[model samples]
Target: MSATTAGGEVVVRNAQGLHLRPATEFAKLAMATGCRVQVRTDAGDANGASVLELAMLGITQGVTLRITAEGPSAGDAVRRLIQLVESGFVV
Candidate 1:
């Protein structure tokens, strides 16, 4: 079998956007999934498993983020990640 890939776009709805706490949460979730994850924006792309990389994107409220995942659980991972972001990382 081959690794699968999944992706989706989500807009930041949090007032603070992706601050450290949320970024940490996002990275932790992405890492925990054990899949390759990438997050992209107009600024650029960043490794979804890296908080520093995610912060570097400078995401802000209303910014549309594109998340992609590849691996055994790509579909589920992408869906959950998109849900997380869309929910404004509200826990």
Candidate 2:
């Protein structure tokens, strides 16, 4: 079988934006899904599983991000990730 790819757009809702804590949370979630995730903005792209990489993107609040995931559970991974961001990384 071949791996599948899924992607969608998600907006940052938190006033603080993708700060250290939220970036770490997002990376952890992406890593746990066992999928290769990538986040892209008009500025550039970064590995979704790496907190440092995500932070480097400098994504701010209200920014619409394009997230893509590739792996056996790509679709679910993408959906969950989008939900995470849209929900403001609720703790």
Candidate 3:
């Protein structure tokens, strides 16, 4: 397993947060960051860039997700991802 790294967090504000479409889009955007990204919720944790794993987080509209990325571009990755999630996963 990779070492646990600290990044940032974003609270979900969308009325229909983290559903299929938004999760899918978030995963795609995260993958494009070229870093290992993961998301953590009260229930569990999962790969941030994987649609299946993200969906498994079971996040509701008002839930907060802790986002972490590790590797060379981890900072940039987290920033972009935080923005995406904060924007209701519109990206």
Sort every candidate by TM-score, greatest first. 2, 1, 3
Q: Write the per-residue lDDT of candidate 2 for residues 7-73, one digit (tens) a residue.
A: 9998899998899999999999999998999999887999999999899988899888999999978
Residue 24 displacement in candidate 3 (angstroms) = 0.8
Give lDDT for model 2: 0.92
How many clashes (backbone N, Cα, C below 3 Å) per candidate? 0, 0, 0
TM, every model: 0.95, 0.95, 0.88
- How high is the lDDT of residue 34 in model 2? 89
Give me the runs in candidate 1 sitting further than 4 Å from their true place. none
Better of 1 and 3 by lDDT: 1
Q: Clash pairs of candidate 3?
A: none
CA deviation > 4 Å runs, candidate 3? 1-6
Give the residue spans of candidate 2 off by over 4 A: none
TM-score of 2: 0.95
